[model samples]
Target: MTIATELASPSPSAAAASSASSADSASGAAPAVPPLLVPKGEYPRPDLDRSERWQSLNGEWDFSSIDGEARITVPFAWETPASGIERTWLEAATYRRALAVPASWADARVVLCFGAVHHRATVSIDGVVVGTHVGGYTSFEFDVTSHLTAGRDAVLEVAVESPADKRSIVHGKQRSIPRDDYDGVSFTPTSGIWQSVWVEARGRTYARSVTLRGDSLKGIDVAVELAGDAPAGAAVRTRVLGEGAAPAAGVATDARAESATDAAGGLHPVDAELRLTADAAGRASGRLEIGSPQLWSPADPHLYRVEVIVGEGAGADRVVATTGLRSLEWNDGGLRLNGDRLYLRGVLDQGYWPETGLTAPSDEALLADLDLARELGYTMVRKHLKLEEPRWLHRADELGMLVWAEPAAPSRFSPEAAALFEDQLEPMVRRDGNHPSIVVWGLYNEEWGLDWDIPGSRRRAEAAAHAYDTMAALDHTRPLVENSGWAHVKSDLVDWHYYEPDPATWAENVRDLATGVREAFPVKLGPDFVVDKSLYGSDEFPRTGVPLLNSEYGEGYTSLERAWHLRWQTQELRRHDRYSGYVYTELADVEHENAGLLDADRRRKDWGGLRPADVNADTVLVVDLVPRAAGADIEVPLEAFELTVRVSHHGADAVAGRVEAAWIAAGAPLPASPHGEASSAAVPAVSPFVLGAPVTLTIEPPAASARLALFFVDETDAVRARSYLDAAPVEAPNRRGARPAPTPAP
Candidate 1:
């Protein structure tokens, strides 16, 4: 929607960078494969990385599915055209691939890992059952050291079942039986083996996982988990580097440049080392203090390089991670990060692509979404109903994008389904909680698993509460919302979703919801039906003294009119100082949902030649005029119109700027050129006006149509925000169709 083209296209170099980190390139065991099936050879785990010790099994694999047996791509689901098995979703499938054990990895333990497998997966190596994983949205792994001999090939078989009855499992936007479910918002299924599968070599007594807990005022608490035959008193050494060091040695130059710079551009964070001893359970933790720490936020996402080593040199394990040192809290009825008020000018990201389903085409594809978010002037993005790839979160850390992470939810209510929902929270938190970009964790959305009857069923309310407590135990640093958008069973913030087409009414409801004057949220369950705002909330979570945000708000449609609705709807959000922030319905089109700034192909719509950031910037100009029909031009008086304008500044400091206005006729040059070029002088410019002041706009009405454009320019003469008003001259009643003359005579 914005004119800036900062996102990079997926290139062969990106794929090479990923595979080069793996040992397969050195061993030369992987067969030459078609680029179409193996579009990406990227590393799946940038966090907690031991890149060189791993081998990618992400290219071609022997595959079969319910839709009929065929060869398929490893990470691409069959439902997508990219997967050679381009057919309808298959509920069951079996994959067989050859796993070559490099002779150099003989002394280390070989662990098989899956970024994720749909619904249910049973894995076996060399005819021996290794492990089974349920819940498709979380990562799982197994150690297969005993089954394989060094330099020999082993058969890796994975049998997967993604039941058609998705109501019993955690499926995000993926559709199941009753295809019209989710109000027709569900999409093609992301079935088995949809994410990367790989094997990494680790020491027999190595660090399996490391958690970094960072605080700007204090320091970092490094927690290490060791697996395999670890000694009773195993020790872990933690070293956090300053701004310039790479995460590890032998990494590519592009990756090194990514890790070396801090977006905050502040003083270098403390570089130091601390050691801790593991007990019988093989756990170790220690805190490293930084005298002056650089905090991470959307404005500046500065990551601290962390390296941890376990055991001694001969049989040691090493892991490199990038951690952000930051802190957030509630203050003045709003969320604050790094002691500054945080207004989440956010967009809802569904994390889907036309060809890749949910899997990324390349590592750059993940960064492209964050790049789009930054271009649109969004400070945050609410990942709707999906747990995205770790590379996405890692790029958010690099590019300074805040995230509100939510996992997939079930479609129906049942005790078993509720347990499945509860079971998924721990892994979600454990996997994602360390990232500073993720400011909040959401469990369920709109009571989907509770059959949307949170008010009627006590059992449903208990399920929501159980999830709240489960996540509270795993993570306390970030805010937790049990049920987002309505009926907050247990949450740190009271957020709601109201999709009102009328700007005046949306403004009224948003102010009321923010002030507690309105307790119930208006629900638009479907196009033909409307449920009035009746259900306020249950008694489980109190609403008093909490931050209020409209987590979702927008109308459904496409193009300039859609952009028009986004502008007005979000204006109401920024107008109310009582509110914290807002997340628009979406960033890109998904399946049947057309309420997106960009299409499913990630291309901008025809927004009437306007930049989307004009209305979405952190510091924007809000004009006080309710919109008329979105596609139609307003019939203003022949000469002039009066309106009030104000600055809605959410930056860390107060805003200082001048507001400029100009009127240009149809087919005229934009105000962007020199103050008055020949083409631009068809209309005139208005004198500068102070913000928050009423100003009269005058125009010598052109014979055709015209547009009144406004801009907010800071002291540096750079335009920070811009808006437009389409107008046509008012016409008198038709004289030819004169029944009026006869009525006057009578």
Candidate 2:
């Protein structure tokens, strides 16, 4: 049934639409499901997409879980509905399927790759054990070249064990018991294969992996790791996807025309003949110089698509990756991107979904989350406690969103646990090291896998320090947080969390950190929580110039509070010279933690009557709310007041605009439109604002509650930036506390 076919290539827009058609067809009022009933086809790694040479192992597989025996989808975990086995809290599962080895791959070394498998997975093909992997977050592969019989079907079997309550395995937010944690941060557990799996056919000598790096002054530096026999004169060639008026040689004309790249692609291709000496360890390094380098920033995420070709023509193995040229450094009490002092306005993203658990139903779902963060004007996202799929990271880089990647943690510490973590760390670092979006590697969070009851325990500190050193050994480019929040041992940065809602109290805490007076912020810890004084002190075990951040903060009771709290807190943090940055509690509400600016489904929240857009802006117009008297009722006084305004641009680009301010009472007669006097000012990008002898605003709080609003608009009157604060009639707790809702955001 072999046939030769020449199909017309699809246009860029048509191709994009066609790719999205599958997910769009399957998605409905409910969360999306993969369209393919047999679910395989799409290339797993877009970064190294060699579509013609790879085969997907997704589709249907014979599955057996504790509940019963049934068929399940390959990539979706057994717990998700899309897997055709909606069982949660899974203990173990066995998957079996017959795989066909394409005759085309007979001469090449066949490699089986698993994007990720939960907890533990043991693989066997045709009754022979092939390999075994233990971590749930990192990808693993096995060379099955010798085991494959040329013209026969191969039986592939995978046995997976994932106990939700296992203390030795790294599981992020995956709860053993339902809603186990006090604050409701814990979530439903996932088990079995939860990501793509495939087979790659490569030549005898092939490229194992590629690492790309670049800066303003230097050309693209590429490091290629090879596998198998080394050729006598193997060479590494680097080519920018599309460079000059003429397309690159050997590249597909259609691909060169439609692929993502700079306007004219990248600089011309450059090849370096590797010095593979008698004892040369399978490694090749080279550089591709571009005369005119385009810098990457949040405002303009310019990317250069690079193609790394190993060996000679026809037999050469080719892989592509998108890279950005930029420099980052941490010094002088702040972070610098491309030598510009930057502040990270980020939200904690858990990467969870109502229907799919940790697995995003589709690529669009992942993009939607990043797009929502962009709309909220957040420059970064702290991927808290979860090792997300590479596609998610790729999207962040494409969208110009910065990321703080964290590894999932186990419940308790042990020798076995440490060994498993160490085994997983190397792959994690190498797999993601090439990403430009990731700036920090968060080693441990709140000491989840280190120690439970000990504060500054020698054993725990040593463990944290060891982990830090190990990570540094693997990746020296990114900043490392030894342990986030408390109990920091050896790290490039240290941070602490506080959930205080009052702006004044937040300001007071900031002053304490600025003056080097370390003290704990009193807040309610769970019943299982223990008092750890040393962990709370900033000065006790401090490093000389490590930047301090209020990394985690703000849990508001209402939507109004959520928006107001973030605005005021961010302003306060930036006002001080000592603090580096801040990441709010979350981007969207998760389970019972209703402290997000957006609700569970990523919708606008009004507390009872507020718009999400009002509190979110790329370039915000900050106004000083009138301070209450010393004895004022534990609430912001609802009275007429005068305030000053400052224009601040929080994005990576400067903005020039007309500023407008107004106060609108909830029940007052409506005016034709917002009528306010305007002034012009140029707002520089990030951190420090243009504080032009603040314009005073005189407004009267209505007979009831009201909204004080400020907006900065461009020449066309389109709002470039905006902010709003709520005025309440009386001091009262939020109408409701945290409640889990499955409804999508409005």
Candidate 3:
């Protein structure tokens, strides 16, 4: 048998580190006492779901802690209240559960899988140790067939250790003691088994892992890694499931199909077999071609399911995988999806809830965030710092949202820290690479872990360059970012974080953005800050034609000013041909970061007259009449003003929309007919959303400051489907903080 039955021995230093982590956990503070049982027993990997041959090991488990033995939930962390043991940082804990193997799999190989353990864990079945793993964010497995007696009660035990100090490992936002790099952005730490645990029964020759890639429209590449050697003359059978089928049970058919469907009506995706004679490395790979493939996009997220089966008859093992066909590239100095120039109207999603800490309350709870994003008109999300659950990524695919997958940044830099950073980065990309929604792989964020002493230091630059090269090699299917904030070191995209709240100052800054940002860094971040003064050899910015994006901006106190700021910032970014898109600071308030469009409890913040559809739309209409003086009178006499209205489309889908504007006195009702005076030329939807000829509307203002309401109505009669722009007087500080329009209660 090729599968090893013994657990790998730990090195002397690793053993010492484990002991130290245990000691730290014992000395740390305890979290609120979680309940005795709060189960998350669902199948962990829905992307490759195999529930028929699997059993959830999630409910109650006998746990032993510093406070003594107690019953705790299997998936919820020990520190989370849901686990019934609210202990913040615990030393070493042992979890024991009882289960009986299915009678039909008496001689089959049984594997136990854990989605994620906090830091480290050792697993044993019955009484023999089976396997061990040392990462908190990646999934791990153990072969437990030999340790179990079939059709009988078997005891499964796991010992987990989580270090109190985050510096001990590559702990991402989890904090016990706050540091400069972590402070307000970091959150409370969680420990123990924080993800699902389950068991799978498979044949002797099972498929261990499958890596899917490439766009489905052209052809998809598939590689399967096997466990144990294939018997003589045995071949590996692969098939892609027809739409609407359960992911695991792919339609059975011939080796390959000439059309999209077979005679039996099963999907005819590239079905083929690999002869074991050429499998020297226990790996098989091939390409799949499908006719009339559906492309995946934020508006239409379509996924294709595939299955790889090894062996034959009752002893066969099947592995399922889901993927979508979509190409994401930065070419001709702009971002494109499926060869169409597209702008990413996105928001930064922190992936934190007030009660769950790191984990969401349920799968639906996570889906609610996506639903909220779509409702707010955001096409994409930058999943900041934390790596979310796979189901969350799947939901993004189902809901038509794009994701920029970011690695969790460590707080400090050291030799061990560097090792940990590279160690986890590869698995993160490999595991999530098949998902079409993840278009970009983010290496580090704003230099959180690699913060060196000197600005533009060689050490920092070298480190970033190395990380970029390393991540690029693993997954060449998506764009790679070295450092997101100010420093640009060999990255596909150069992103910036500008939080200037004043509209006029912001306008001045954007006037000379490329240069003003370069010079303002040292002063903005202080002298000792760590940032590169040049990108490669370019003194101002990267001259490699890399796309530019304002990854973060916006912090206004009042509803009126915030709305205006969002509109102004988005409009300004759109003006620059080189600027691909912009992602606002956040979608919702996370803990103390109150700059979200929605508050901490997921409540909508009144954004004056602006709705989500207004801020994030493929087609937008902006009325730039020029700002009035800062201290202008509250009331103005009726006067004629030249309003230059610009109508532009951000997507490649050219649309026919009519523009209509009307002047209404303050507090006066709008006309019910929904008609206007002037007709707008057809707005072509393409890369540069700017209009060639601006529609100069001569507005005869009323006695008071009149509200100029403009609408970009589509061919359809749906008004909300179109974007509306309401021009109003900017408010002062005291006028800020007005209660936002009431939303359906959260």
Candidate 4:
């Protein structure tokens, strides 16, 4: 049953409801029309925004697939609950809508835009096929000026086909029936239009495209591609309205200016604007500097308001955007952001939602996820497999969050799949190149599209290297990870993924990998399969003098145990001064993998007594105690207990600090020096030292059950780090097999 009957006009107020709807989504509440039959109303393209001339076509649409017929939303995939038709996967679908170009814009050109559609999409207006676009994760557009009927409504239809097979296409983490290599990690497939769709009326002569880049905090460069009637004499003029800093609290101003600001208040007038004349191709580019340069970082993400106008006056094309200044460098010592040594406290973000699948329920939901990641004390999030939505990247820029972005990858090795994967690279980079928050571009994950055999296949290794070279050539501002997690044939930073659960074995293996003691390392792909990794790709592209990072690790049957592993395994990484950074298994759990700190719904899981923020902070105390299990505590008999203490400091400057030791008991008076100053000698920066003269604390008195605590207090009397051990005295011999006495209350 094909359903393409004409639908009624959309509500006039639907466009204005986006903000209120977003507010509802922020509080875990459902919006009015929600994602169904109503536009999310966000201008999808902030980089090249022309809000005054565009209209959203996101509200209502008639959808029919082979499996069924229903009214579906434009952006949400039919497989998601937000789509209004939670149908299962299908090969093909048709979307129909009725739109009319405003007659007042008769002299203008109307173009249809689809932010993204999975697999393939064929667009048509008034029964005439206009264009066809392939690939799932990237956006596409078409000019529909000739097909439009001006003031009268015209029937618009889109045909979408997403294949059942996963091998040939660059699918990333999206999964179908017959699973792919990463089946265990893959989530639900997104089919049909899964992002915003709209129509924009452009001037007769307009800017076709624009690009902005940060020139290492000194200045910014801009380029514009003009089209339509624009000629060689026409020019692209760029002006800085202000710097990248938000306004003060409670100030009413432009949302764009407000969201990108810091206390520095980067609103300075530019005395002069830079203009570049278009060549025969109607392309122009030039460099310009800001009044007061401020670099972007997690501490302060300042943005400068750059407006690029083509030609002049009211009919001219204008693109208002924001950019941040920053520089990145990676070497044997580690990564540096603006010349300051930085550690990547990162987590994996799969970019899936419970209700929306690949689409976020709302813009707030997007920000909320980043907020949650920051709450977990993560400085960077590796967008695994998928190139995240640009809005996610934009929000990351506003919040000063760093990103490790990767494009969608084809599952198998084939000329077709490789070509398809290569086809996706330039678009992905160009779409996201302007964002300052993105610091690294990952070409492949574990050699996924190359049959997971970069070492064995020379062609595959070259393909990976070629991908790296392509990305590096386009954007030399950031490092390129040829293949993350393992088998880095060509990479700016060398990273490996390990999931050894045992503390002793994990530390030993980490030390081996960090120290280059082992030529070959085993990569645990799943519960059954393991492959020995080599550096065959390094023969041609040497990466011997690169920084090392544990891009992925941690495995636990339960969340508490995972948190426990996170607590100590992180210390083990910091134990060696060689490690540049580490990214835990994930920030939020995906479908079947429960290794994330947060559950699938983006809610925090029970971590027992552990606090993730405390363990993940920049500065922390690492105690030398390896427990067999997370629930396993300590045992004592009225005797002395000894342990070593070390400081893992990533602060900007060194501080002289001493270790403070104390004892805590349940429902009992506090023991002495329990609050007194630590007896350990003061040491500056990150160094290991023994607490007390002989590094031993004697348990004196009534053999009371208690836990001893340690703290690192700096010379300024500020406590920089702390840790504690729960111990109870051993009980008298009994038939119960010498169980320890119950822990006392403090």
Candidate 5:
């Protein structure tokens, strides 16, 4: 959390006149031009304390083609509209920009930062090499303090080369296609400064890195690292803020801190704490306490905020960070959070934007996801191998959305691929570890990493397992999901995949193989195709006593209207009592996978007829049990009008159960088991019941219906199974509206 406030010192807009041709600008035309999209919005990092004086170099920059006869936009690759260049490929490109340094920065150290650059990038200022950085997901900075001239403008240039198909780097889901196979979509690779670029001034000694850890029993511990030279008696102070206006502060001696002096004098380590307090705002505070703290449960999430101040002997800068305090433990029972059994109602989130592809439409678009999850009764989301921008995590923390962060794995597992995965994944975790929303680290998905039966596959699995263990050991605060969907080895949780409509089929399989074998089984089933099941369970589950969970289900692509469909389907399925919980196929659609609850544009489909349960006071008929003794009776309540009940029994003697109906308000005893068959003792206004165990009952109130309880009983009162029929208000069909459409196959 770095906070840098600067007075509005207007600079020349990127839209200023340039000599480049329009064909090379973000908007491709006759004259190639430069990208004019400046980074004027608030910088993403507000938690970090930064200087007030700064400038953005993100907009238009001078450009020249590195290869061939094509010319393109400065920052945007030749392939995107925002770049004003639509060339499909760029083997090499050079970008240049000029900025006038203010006389105020003459005596101050100057630093240049690039939000992101694809593949490899080299930076040069005034034709002198300054710095270089690899990898596209992380940010890099260079201290250009020595290359500054007072009141004189500086020329900054960058050379970029990216073969989007290269497997050596972490490209996430970017694809490479034949030259002529381009589709009219924004799925092409984005290169070079897709994010903001700015310059900030730092004090002689500044805080480098901060790591915050919390233990439920021992409270929170803060570790801070500082950079640059520190005086002998330097001290670092940290403050904790929440609902209270004032913050609590803690001080530590700089002499005891571990310094990254050899490596650019960056701070490597510094530890402080705030005990749990009742005044903490829980999830509302944007911060919380640790000791005996209200743990961050899926049902009720809580987070804490930490502020760090670095003083050189006495005068230092300050930074702020928001984090959640909780712990994850893996035992024979399964994954547990805060010492409680945790069930992951998760969705595979594919971070994609219809307009910007990997880039989000806006910060609001990111926050909308968490809000949607809360509405749908989900608490967790798997990032699905893609690392998101930091702002995404910030929203997750604020919305209390738990995250399973996975590193993108190569399609094939080669020795080189393994090295690449390790290289990129380690830094990703270290950079994102501070966020409380990230609870699980997923190593591999399915067979993405290695061949299941190959000789070397075992070693790969072992190495992956060891890597998972190492991450857990490094920060035991979160659980490690060794492999997701398939390929379970020596891991903590047993994860599996199934793609069948019948949930009971897989449930029985697990029962026969694990519990029936009577052997020690630590594997927990992670069903991938459970969302499509119509009947969650069958007769086999009652006999086998197998415990099953709905790990994956409901992946229908989201549309505005589909929201109603989801509510309808969810209500219909919960009555079965077979699934533990459901993890929908996806949170957002990525590429061609349209099975997302949200569209690529991040807009919710309009569900016209169906309303949120809260807004519409419609009562649903929930039948707890279907069949009982013929002489026994059932009970139902009136809430909504629609009623449908299915009864099934185990015995051949259908006469064992009976349904005797009664209207409690009218004081009239009605006939038992209405509909299907006629009985000898028939009461007025009551339908008869059949001798069969499973009898279908349909009750349509004849216009005059009251808020009354309907009771069904047998002679002995032994068959006490009940069904509830709620009275629903009549809904008028919308003749002006379109007809109801059929639900699409998931």
Candidate 6:
């Protein structure tokens, strides 16, 4: 059934009478003016045949505050800006809108589709009860065909109630503060219809569901399930289309008599046979052989169109869907896609809007985000811990951006919680599986599920594994990340979380330490003293030469110094060979987390202010051990005077030692502590080391460094320190012997 009939208008006389009553109640005081709720654009999905006839019910609507059983703008709720009536709190609110059924949908089935409602929503047409929907994220539809008055406009009314401090439902990251949540201000309430409302028209016996499955290089396999009755000798036709290809079609005979069971031992085969005449059943099956399918990659996204037409004895209905082909696999090494090792360059994306909150203003706004990521050279994005509208996934598929789809985590998890989570997760996979851009299904994040103790941990892990297994069974095209961070078990990929910057320290301390433990000590006590399994089976798990990714990093507040003087320096420091990629704390300054790339208004803080360092000309100073013997000096020649020295342990820990340096001549002994107190010169040895275990020292030219040499000492002289020199010397012969590179304009 279509969404149109579901929201058909009430009788014209009834709407007029309701309008008159509303006017009388307002005493002609211009009533509350609801914000113009125009549809951002067309319906996101075109694959469904029913989507073609859908019309968005987004724009302007008559409204009133429901103080005493009054009416207001629908779907917008009373608290939101769009609702036009911004009451801080309301026990209950009613919203009404007048809509006329399209004359062309006289014979077709009409349906009303609501993208989402805040809490509990009850719908009525022409003052007659039609349907009710619970939950805030999932879409709901109603068959309004029987309730509509032919050729007359109808009144659609929705009543909504969203109470504060309710933990029964899943509300991710939303908090209620006593009149001061952020910057000492109370949190505002978010009520009613935060999404879109629309109508659709559909014919009888339409395609009910569809599944597209395939790998990166291989073409996708299409499977369909149809509903309604059809006679014998019916033909089911299917077509596949690409951007340049003319549509291709195939036909299958219906076989209605065959019986099949689903995975749960239920009698519902997604695709059922059609019984035409007595004793003769018909079923349609065929494959669309696509040769050399254009693989969908974050670098270059491509999509193909699949259309299916199920024909009865005389008539047929068609549904069209867009899908991409991609595959993901995990070997002993790491993640592989399309037979090649792929590194996920990703950022944690929290989809939010200032004006509309969760709902975007338009489709362009949605696509703009994808464009921003693409332009900034991010191929993948971890969707954080929230579910997005289906259209967001569609945009990813179309733009070719890889997605790590995460389930919204609740503070606690019970049996009921598990069931609700599964319900949301299953539909998410089903709706997005066809898109090649979605490569990973994330079940849990940061120990969100309740019960981290032994049995509880095991249960949560098993439940997460089951969810992944379910996704794999449903669509085996993508790999699953059982749990994102801690409380992880043996799953596809070993996921961990850390909040540190200093790349040198991360590389020497964290990365090397983690790798060593994963190798020699496969299992050990975790932070909570609980026995934890190894992230890798052996030392070779990470593959010594392969890139060890730091997926999550950077939670430090954006220093004003970094923004004004060292703009982009932090981001540039994160680009190293040993470093796969890092996700900065967030996209925007969220509450207390000021580590955002942009401000609240989405404007970049320091645009076109700084330039990235030239990787080829840059020199990286590496030292083996810390706390070198006091008064000990090492002589070294500088090629390109500009250098970034990094001192740290070979594990993941903060650098706690000290280093005192002096620029001795080519053959001169370092003067006895010429630079007194280590803090006298331009390059001083500061105490109480700032960075984690290993320290990173970035040196800019014009300071002091032609034939530079250094004397270093650790706090204690227990172990010998080794220093390695691996410099990417500039390709200039004249300036070879310890000469600094020319400084750039500040």
Q: Candidates' lDDT values, in order?
A: 0.72, 0.66, 0.66, 0.72, 0.48, 0.49
lDDT of 1 by residue, 170-234 (tens): 89788887553574778888888788888887765777777887864478888888876564588
List all candidate RMSDs to the true structure.
9.1, 10.1, 9.5, 9.3, 14.5, 15.4
lDDT (tens digit, per residue) of candidate 2 on 1-746: 00111122334334334333432443222211233433534566765655546667887899976677899977888888888898887789999988765544444556788878888888888877777777888887776766664335679999998886756667767776523342246776778898888877665556777777775435677777876445334666667665332323553322323343345554555422222211266677767777777777787787777776666544456667667887788765667888877667777898877667777777777668888887766778999887788877888888899999988876677756656665667888767777788888897777767754225466766677788898889876777887788666677776777777667777777677655775555644575664533334224565547777777887566675565566677666655557667787888877676877777777777644433334444455656553221112113446656656666655544555566656566423323344664343543233343332355555555454555455666556667666555555454446676777789979
- Number of the top candidate by TM-score? 1
Clashes of each: 0, 2, 14, 12, 62, 54
lDDT of 5 by residue, 84-150 (tens): 5555567567777775545434434456766567667788888887767666655666756556453
Ranking the candidates on TM-score from highest down gives: 1, 4, 3, 2, 6, 5
Off by over 4 Å in 1: 1-37, 65-69, 242-270, 533-535, 539-541, 631-633, 667-670, 673-704, 714-718, 729-746
| C-alpha positional error of residue 381 in candidate 3 after TM-score superposition, expressed in Å | 1.3
> lDDT for model 6, on a 0 to 1 scale?
0.49
TM-score of each: 0.86, 0.82, 0.83, 0.85, 0.63, 0.66
Cα misplacement distance, residue 2 of candidate 4 (Å) = 29
Worst 10 residues of 5 by lDDT: 277-286
Better of 1 and 3 by TM-score: 1
How well does candidate 2 match the true structure in TM-score terms? 0.82
Candidates 2 and 4, the one with greater lDDT: 4
**Candidate 6 residue lDDT tens string, 1-746:** 00112334465345434433443333222221222335554664643434535566766555444455443443454565655666655646667787655444444445677777766778888888787765655566675766653345679877776656434344445443221112121124456776778776544344555677656355556555554333234455555643333222222111211111122243221221222221124334445556656776655677767766665332244566777666777664456677655556566676665555556556777667766665544567787666666777888887777887876544455666655555566556555667777877777655454433323555666666666676566655665666555444434665555543333444444545334443211222243343443333233333343323444555333443222212122323333333333444445554344555566555665422211121111121233322111111111223323334443222222223444434433324334333422211232332211212234333222222222333334445221122222112233245557778799999
**Candidate scoring better on TM-score of 1 and 2:** 1
- The list of candidate 4 runs beyond 4 A from truth reads 1-39, 243-268, 540-543, 636-638, 665-679, 685-707, 728-746
